[model samples]
Structures are given as structure tokens and as C-alpha cells.
Target: MTIHHHPSNETLATYAAGTLDLGRRLVVASHLDRCDACRKAVRGFEQVAGTMLEDLPPTTMSADALARTLARIDGLGADESRRASFREDFEPGLPACLRRYELGRWRWIGPGVEMRSIVVPGANDVRVFLLKGAPGTRLPQHSHSGTELTLILDGAYAHEGGRFGAGDFEEADESVEHRPIVSDDEACICLVALEGRLKLSGFMGALLNPFVRL
Candidate 1:
């Protein structure tokens, strides 16, 4: 699939520096898995970061630091292998970045739309979820309070900006408002990370806002 949208350079830099929150990092990683261009961009940023770190003054390490670090790496590898096996047994078709997290049950949010919340580890304010909308589903018009990141996993959707198909990454801020409609040819499945609450528009949006918990 062709990826027409990508995270901004600033976003990629932050991601490479490991400064992004978990939810946003996962969204960017999902995009990187499908977009080779973004993957290369991230690698470039990582190289720059490594160069900067090399110039920093050296710090002394504990006598057993090397042993402890190696043990930690081994532990992490084992844990990651178990998680991958678990994901393969359950949600086998998800993006690799999402496979590490536990997925909640799919819940119907509208006539043709369903949502499944991802259980992120640790305390986080960002909300991450997968939304599946059948063909012809039109979401309510809304604007974000902070930032919202969306990565299309399957099918396509269109809004004021343009049509987003598989591997498209979209970033929305508080200034943008839109109503996305799933393409009639197939259902649309997307992973989303929202930093703040949605400000639904119109009277119908107000009525449904309470029920449309993201």
C-alpha cells in the first residue's frame, strides 16, 4: 500500500529520542511498520541522537552494572517473546506495535461502528483504541482539545482533508474539525491515540457525545 501521509519530522525526532508518550509512540510505530520512508527518517534521527550522546561526558558505572544490564536485556527479550506468542494466539492480524498490548473486547459504539480499547501499561492519560467502521459509516463531527493521531490499518475513509487508506497517518490538533466517513467499498479499521477529549459539534453530536466514549 502507498502511504501518502506521515508523521512530521519533529514528531519522528521526538519518537527517536524516546520522548513521546506511549500512545503516540505506538501510533508512529504502526506507521513506520508500513512506510519505509518514515522508517528511514526515524533511523536518521536516531543516528543524530547517537552522535550527540557520543559527545557527552562519560559517567562512571557500578561494578556490577554490566552484568545487571545484560540480565535486564535477557529478561526483556523473554517477556517480549511471550507477549508476541500471546498476540499471535489471539489478535494475529494487528500491527506489530499493537501486538504487545492487551486488547479489550469490541463494543458497539454506533450502528455500524465498534471500538476496542487497548490496555497500555503504566499510568497514562492518553487514550488508545482501535475503531472499526463498516462501509458507509459516518462519524459525528468533532474537534480535539489537544492532539489526535490516527493510523489507518485497513480499508479507507475520507474527510475534509482527503482520503486515508491503509498506512495513512493523520495528525489533528484543536483547530481542526472534521467528520470522517468510511468508504463504501469496504470497512475501515484504524488505530487512534487521543491526548484530550473530543469536542463534538452540532445538536446530534451533543446527544451522542456522552455515549461515544473514546
Candidate 2:
């Protein structure tokens, strides 16, 4: 698949530094799984981070620090093995990064539009969901109150930002305001991570915003 859109360098750097929130991290991880270019970029960032750590002044540690660190490393290896096993048995249609989350049932939000909430443990105000639009459907025109990351899982849609196909990752902030319309050929399924509430515009969006909880 040809991925035209990707996470910005700043976002990737934040992700590599483990500073991005869980919701946004999951979105970026999903995109990275599909886009090799982003994966290479992330690896480069990690290498730089490692080099920086190596250059830092050395510090003394407690007597049991080494033992504790070794134990943690062993536990992490076990956790990774379990995660790999889970990914192997995960749903084929969903992204590997999303397999760990609990997905709610799909609910209709608008004509030809359905949303399924993904519950991330300990998540507060932020929200994550799988949004699917039927062919030729036009989503409400709206702007984000905070950052919004969208990763296309299937089909395609077009907005002012560009025409996004499968594997495309779009990042939108408060400045963006556009209505996305799914192509006529097939339904569009996307994984969306919202940092804050969506600021919907127009009569239709206003009427549905409160009920949609988007």
C-alpha cells in the first residue's frame, strides 16, 4: 500500500520519547505498523535518543538496583512474548496495535455513519473510536478543539487536507475544518484518536454533537 500521509516529525519524536499519551501513541503505533517509512524514522529517532543517554553523566545506583533492573527486564520479555501471541490471534481486519484495547459495540451516529468506541484503561477525557462511513457519505463539517489523529484502515476519503487512502495517517488540529466524504466505491473505515471534544459546525453537526459524544 502507498501511504501518502504520515505523522509529523515532532509527533514521531514525542512518540519515540514515550511522551505522547496512550490514545495518541496507539494511533501512531497503528500507522507505524503499516508504513515502513515511519518505522525507519522512529528507529532513527530511538538511536539518537540512545546516543544522548550514553553521553549523559554517569550516576551511582543502589545495591539492589541491578537485581531489580534484571528482574524487570525478564518480566518485560515475558510480557512481550504474551503480546506477540495475542497479536497472532487478533482480528485480521484490525490493526495489531489496537488488539489490546476493549472495543464497544458499533452505534449509529448519523446516516450511513457508525462508531465503535475503544476503551483504553486509565484514559480520562480523551477518546478513541473506529469510525466507518458508508460509500458516498459525507461526514459533518467540524474542527478539533485539540489534536486529532486519523489512520485509514480500509477504503478512502477526501477532505481539504487531501485524499486519504488505506494506510494514510492524517493529523489535524484546531486550525483544520473540513468535511470528509468517503469514495463511492467502498466504505471507509478509520481509527480516530481525539485529544479533546470535536467542535462541530452547522445545524446538522450541532444537533448531533451532544448525542454523538465525539
Candidate 3:
């Protein structure tokens, strides 16, 4: 799969530093699973962080800190085992990063467009979902109130930015306003993370916005 779009440098840096919110982090992780270039960039950022830490002045830790850390490390083994088992039973055709999420039933949002909410624990205001567009379908024209990250999982779509095929990651904000149309023969499926509510454009979109809840 050829990926023409990717998360911004700032986004990738925040992700590597563990500073991105859970919803956005999940979106970036899903993209990284398929984009080797972004994976390398994340590793580079991690290495830089490690080197910076090594250069910092030493600080004494609490007596129980080491014990607590060791205990947490031990617990991770069991947690990883459970995660491995879960991944083994994960649904086919979905990104590996989505294995841990609970997918809600798909609901029709517009003509040839369907969306399924992704149940993300502790995600209060943020929304995550799987959006599928049938071939030749044009998605609603809208802009976001905050950052939006979209990771293509199957097929392809095109917007003002460019054509996004499987494995492409598109990052948009309030400044962006474009309608995406699926271009592949098959349906286009993408994992989307929205930091804030969408601001629909046009009369039809505004009329249906309240009911759609995207």
C-alpha cells in the first residue's frame, strides 16, 4: 500500500513523548502499524528523548520507587499475554491497533456512507469511529472544530490535500474544509479520531448535522 499522507511532525513527536490524548494516540498508532517511515521517525524521537534523559542530573528516588517499578514491570508480562491473546482473536481486515477496541454497530449517516463508533475507555469528549464510504460516494463537506486524524484501513479516497490510499494518515484541523470522495472500486474504510465536534457545511449537512452526531 502506498501512503501519501502522514501525521505532522508535531503530532508524531507528541505521540512519541506519550503526550497525545488516548484517542489521537490510537489513531497515530494505527497509522504507525502500517507506515514504516513514521515508525522510524517515532524511534528517532524516542532515542532523542532517551539521550536527553541520560544527560539530566541524577536525582534520588524514594525507597519504594524501585520496588513499585519492579512490581509494575512484572505485571506487564501478564498484561501483554492477555493482549496477545486478544490480538490472536481479533477480527480480520481491521488494523492491529483496533484489536483492543469494541466496535459498535454500523449506522447509516448519509447516502453510501456508514459509521461505527469505536468504544474507547475514558474518552469523554473525543470521538473515534470507523467510517466507510462506498465507491463514488462523496462524504459531507465539513470542517472540524479541533484536530482530526484519519487513518485509511481499506480502499482509497481523495480530497483537496490528495488521494489517500490504504495506510495513508490524514491530519486536519479547523483550517481545512474539503469533501472526500471514495475513488476505489471497493468501499473505503478509515479509522477517524476527532478532538472536537464537526462543523458541517452546506444546507443539507447543517440540516442533518444534529441527527448524524459525527
Candidate 4:
């Protein structure tokens, strides 16, 4: 599939530097697994980071540090290696970065819409979840308190900005406010990492906001 959207360069740089939070990092990883261009961009950022590190002054380390590090590396199992890339065997009908996560039951949030919470370690303010919208489903019009990262896994959706098909990545913040409607061809499934609350608009959204946890 042709990917029409991607995380911003700042976000990719942060991801390459290992500074992004777990939830956001997982979202980017999911996109990287599907988009070759983003993967190349991230690799370039990593190379830049490596060069910067090389220019820094060296620090003293314990005489046995190398051995200890090597031992730790050797101790890592197949699962650890798999996490470094995509693992097809981990789970079915889910993104590679999310295969290891425990997906909660799908709960109806609105007409033709369902949501499944993803159980992530070190649970914080970030809300990580899966959203499936049946054909022709129109989601609530809303913005965000902070950042919102969404990765389309299956099918497609469209809003004012553009159409987002499978493997597309969308990033929005408080400045964005639009309703997404699923394509009529099939259901749309998206992996989402949301920080802060959903600032739903309109009277209907205001009424639902109190009841909706997302």
C-alpha cells in the first residue's frame, strides 16, 4: 500500500534518539514496519545521532564493563531480538509492535464504532488503544489536549485533511479538529496512542465526552 502520511521529522528524530515515550514510540514503530521511506529516514537520524556521540569526549568505564555488556547481550533471547523488528508469529490481525500487548475486549463507543484498550506496561497518562470503525462510520469531531498519534492498520478513513489508508500515520494536536469517516468499502482498524484528553466538540460530543473515557 502507498502510505500518504507519516510522523513529523521532529518526532522521528526523537524516536531515533530513544527519547519518545513508550506509547508514542510503539505507534512510530508500527508505522515504520509498514513504510520503507520512514524506516530509511529513521536510519538516517540514527546515523546522525551516532556521529554526534562519536564526537563527544569519552568517559571512563569499569575494566569489566565490556564483558558485562556482552554477557547481557548474550543473555537476550529470541523474543528480545524479535522486539527489535517485526514478529509475524507474535499475534494475528495486529501490528507488529502491538503483538506483545494484551488487547482488551472491543466495546461499543458509538454507532458502528468499537474500541479496544491496549494493556501497556508502566501505564501513565498516555492512552493506547485500537479503534475499529465499520463501513460508513463517522467518528466524533474532536481535537486533543496534547498529542495524538494514529496508525491505520486496515481499511481507510477520510477527514478534511485527506484520506488515510492502510499503513498511514497521522499526528494531531489541539489545533486539529475534524471528524473521520470510514470508507464504505470495508471496516477501518487503527492503532492509536493518545496523550491527554479528547476535546470533543459540538453539543453531542460534549454530552458524550463525560461518558467516553477516550
Candidate 5:
């Protein structure tokens, strides 16, 4: 289908600079693989940045200047051939960068909330989950502690923010509290990457709190 929503200019710049985290960079790479528009956009930004650097006043540099500049330039070199590499590395059903992830056994955590983790290679404690809105359900009013990236795998959901259907991705700032309601007749499935512990509220929260350790 289509590439997910184009990353913001800031993200593209970060990708070009090689400063974003690996997980976030992988997501951006995923988009760059399918969207040539974004590819050109990133290239344009890099080119503009390079041009600006050349226009800057010349300054005497220490011995490390060459090495540092080379390191910076290395990340900006997304040659035409890189598209194929990115596509191959992130094929459907399996991400080459995350091939070592062995999904932990999935089980129900609540009436609609269920989770299974795919461990990040070398970082076993760190994992991601595939969650679904069982039947006609949704998430409770909750806020994630860290950056929460939700990619819709199936169906749709509506929240105060708006409606998001299959294939849509929403990045939630930790400050936003949401109660996403399943809009489709079926279910909404999502991939979520979480770091800090999830703080639960409302009823059954205490009951659920003691039930799982993820």
C-alpha cells in the first residue's frame, strides 16, 4: 500500500544526521523505502545543509575536524542504491534489523488488551507489542510514560484527536491521555514500543496491576 504518513522535517534531518535512536531511525527508513517523495525531500534537506555549510565563514580547525566532518557526511550519504537495501531489510512480516526478536507468548491482559513482546536483540528486557481491540473495544483513559508509537495493523479507532484506520500510525506524546474507541465492527490491532512501566488507572486497574509484569 502507501507509505505511512511522512515523517516531519525534523525527523528527516535527524535521520540524515544519524542522531535518532535505532528504533526511530528504523521507522523512518521504513517510510523512506516506499516513499520517493520523502527520499527526495531528505536529500534536498541534506543538500541545503551542505550548501549552507560551504557558505559559512572559514575557521581554523583542530586535527579532529576532518574526522568529525567525515563522520557527519557519512550519515548523509543515502545513495540511490540505499532504497533497495532499506526495502530488503524491512520486508513484510519480518524486519531484518529485528530478526532476532522472538515474540514472547501472547495472552489476554484484559477484556480487550492483550500483549506479546518481540525482544530487541541484545536488549532482551526491551520489547514491543502487538495489541488489538477485542470485538468492539478500546483503550482506557491512559498515558504512556515514554514515546508511544502506534501503527495500525487492522481496522480503525476514533479518539478525541480524530479517526485513524488501518495502516495509519499515530505518535503519542507522553502527556496526552487517550481513550481510543474502536469504530469498526471488527478490531483494531497495533504495534507499540514501550519503555518505562505502564501506570494503570480506573477500575480493575488494581486487579490488572498485579496480574502482569510487562
Candidate 6:
């Protein structure tokens, strides 16, 4: 019921610019659903973008550029309704709604890490990946080649950006190698949208390489 952590400025900018992939967008949208502050920021960014577009000098563009821009906007609207409906159907955990998600049953991967990934509908390279981190444990250091979004469904994660609790949204940049310490009493459950595989760092991470596919 209280205000939670907001998305980074970079994330708000990317979402406004319409360059974020579907997987990541879902995370942002999910958080936006719960965080009013971030929802307002995203809206402000959109208004700024609209103003910038309106300010552009009238110039004839190559037909291709116009088509490409419109196509991108259209793509953004495709599943807005479906995703909104799906998200609205239930709270974060509901057996019936999860059965419709198609993410594999929860699979344990280590002493403290367990997850399942769901392929986003109509998306080719994007996937909705879930992770449950046991309390007092730290997630491995990993970096992404593309954008990644994380929404805390329950518990929390402490990283460079700071603590993120339930309803908090995080968008990790390409340059950020993320390492999050999980809360102690409850498992840190998160919904992440990853565009591609992750690159793990350090010795232990290397040892866990095969099993730690992002």
C-alpha cells in the first residue's frame, strides 16, 4: 500500500522511446500497475516524446522511415489488451492463472535458486523468466547483452541500485552486472524478462555455468 522503488530514469526513457523489447516491457508494465510514482514518470516521458515529435520540422521522410516508425508503434499496441487482461486476472500467485501462463512447473536449480521460464505470446526472442531466491542468499553476478527487467513479486533483492521489495520494478542496463542479496525470512521471487542468454562472472559462477542459463 505504500510507495515503492521506482524504475530508473534510463528505463523510463527507454519505455518512452519505444525501443524496449516485449519481455522487458512486461516487467515495466507489471511494476507500473503497482507503483504509481513510476507510472507517472513513464507518462511524463511519453508526453515529452510526443512534444518532441510534434516539434520536429515538417520534412518529407523516406516512405520507409514513416512505415518503420508506424510499424513499431503498432507492434507496441498488439498485446497491450491481452497482457493487461492476463495481469488483471489474478494476484501474483494463483494456481489457476499460473496454469494458463505455460511457464514450466517450478524447477529447483540449486540450494537457494529455483525458477521457470515462460515464452511471451507472439514474441520470438523474448521470454518471461522467474526466479525464487532463498533468504540470506546472493544471486550470482551476471550481465546481459540486451535489456532485462525485473519485478519483485514477493520479498526483495539488494543490489547496487538498492533494495527492491514487492511491487518494486528494476530495469538492469547492459553495462550493469547484477548481484542481488536475497531477504532472509522469505524467498525473493521475481519475474524477469530477458531478451537473450546471460554472461556469468567469477569462478563459482563459471562452475555453475551450465545450470545457470539466464
lDDT of 5 by residue, 113-179 (tens): 7776655453333346667687567665666676666666567788887777655557666787787
Residue pairs in candidate 3 whose N, alpha carbon or C atoms collide under 3 angstroms: none
lDDT of each: 0.82, 0.83, 0.82, 0.83, 0.62, 0.72
Per model, state how many residue pairs clash: 0, 0, 0, 0, 0, 0
Q: TM-scores of the models, in the given order?
A: 0.87, 0.88, 0.88, 0.87, 0.67, 0.73
Off by over 4 Å in 5: 1-6, 31-40, 52-100, 122-126
Alpha-carbon shift of residue 3 in model 4 (angstroms)? 0.6
Global fold similarity of model 4 (TM-score): 0.87
lDDT of 1 by residue, 40-157 (tens): 9977987898799689998898999889755542332334445664464345457765666788998998778898999888518788988899999988788999899999999999
Q: What digit string (tens of lDDT, one per residue) describes model 2 on residues 110-162?
A: 88999999888755766888999999998989999998999999999998878
At residue 170, candidate 4 shows an lDDT of: 95
lDDT of model 2, residue 164: 99
After superposing candidate 2, which stretches have Cα over 4 Å from the reference? 62-92
Decoy 5 TM-score against native: 0.67
**lDDT tens digits by residue: candidate 4, 67-151:** 9755543322234437645544433567655766776888988778899988888648888998999999888889899899999
Question: In angstroms, how far off is 65's CA in candidate 2?
Answer: 6.8
The C-alpha local distance difference test score for the whole of candidate 5 amounts to 0.62
Worst 10 residues of 6 by lDDT: 89-98
lDDT per residue for candidate 3 within 132-192, as digits (tens), equals 9999998889999988899989999998888999999998998999899899598999999
Give each prediction's root-mean-square deviation over alpha carbons: 3.2, 3.4, 3.3, 3.8, 5.2, 4.9
